[model samples]
Target: MKAFDQLYQKHYPTVFRVAVKMLGDSDEAADVVQEVFLTLFQTMEKGMVVEYPLSWLYRTTLNKCIDKQKYNGRFQKLETAPEGQVEFQSIEKQETRIRVQRALGKLKPVERALAVMYSESLSYKEMAEATGIRFSSVGKTLSRTLKKLEAELKNKKYELY
Candidate 1:
């Protein structure tokens, strides 16, 4: 219990961020994060040791987000802001973020997951382990996925600066 709490404290924010990046809605992301932690808790209760908990968490979160996206249809447009808070980002920055997210949405689920993992600065090894891609293919696959994302952005006239 103590160990699980500590792990949750350490990793919850990362999992949630990944979920939001993948799912586009904070509410949906929060639900997915809850589901991931619940799965972990159940696994622990079953006396199964997750050798790499962070990797396991990432894998599970990404998988859940992909499944949710499939079940819900296309990735929904993210709300510009939460109610009642002044939007502080420069207009250019906000536009860039929205453009990039739209490009990300154009990718297949696995490709989007790879791109998100890359954005998170995950290593090829970590990405492979988390996404179940072959270690040798992670770099190649990510390179192609990134090119695909770039093409999607360019098609939308969203230059990457």
Candidate 2:
């Protein structure tokens, strides 16, 4: 109990930020944080040996965020599809955010997760550790993923946003 509380205090902000960045929703991010802590408590209760709890939490958060996107695909599309008319979000900052989100949607789940982590300035080693990908391949994979995302954003036409 005390250990879990200490873990939560140390990592809650980062976990919540990762969730919000991936899912783009405050409520859902909060839910992910709660779920992660609950799972941690349950696993510890079962006496599992977690060698690296922070890495485990990162992996779990990414998985849950991806699953949430999968489950809410339709709702997400409906929310971000710009409807028939563009709202007042044509201003540069909001427009760029929407464009980025759209491009992210087109990426594979792993790519999306990696890209978001990269955007948050996580090191390649950290990303690889969290994702279980080969450490040496993290840089190459992230570069390739970024190139793909850039191409997608370009192909979608910069004028639309």
Best by TM-score: 1
Model 2: lowest-lDDT 10 consecutive positions: 77-86
Off by over 4 Å in 1: 78-86, 158-161
What C-alpha lDDT do the candidate models reach, one value each? 0.85, 0.80
Collision pairs in model 1: none
Could you give candidate 1's per-residue lDDT for residues 34-107 as a string of tens digits? 99999999998888999999999999999999999889877764433222232777767666667777788888
- The candidate that wins on lDDT is 1
- Clashes (N, CA, C under 3 Å) per candidate: 0, 0
RMSD of 1: 2.6
Give residue 49's lDDT in candidate 1 (0 to 100).
94
Give the TM-score comparing model 2 with the true structure, all chains together.
0.80
Residue 8 lDDT (model 2)? 93
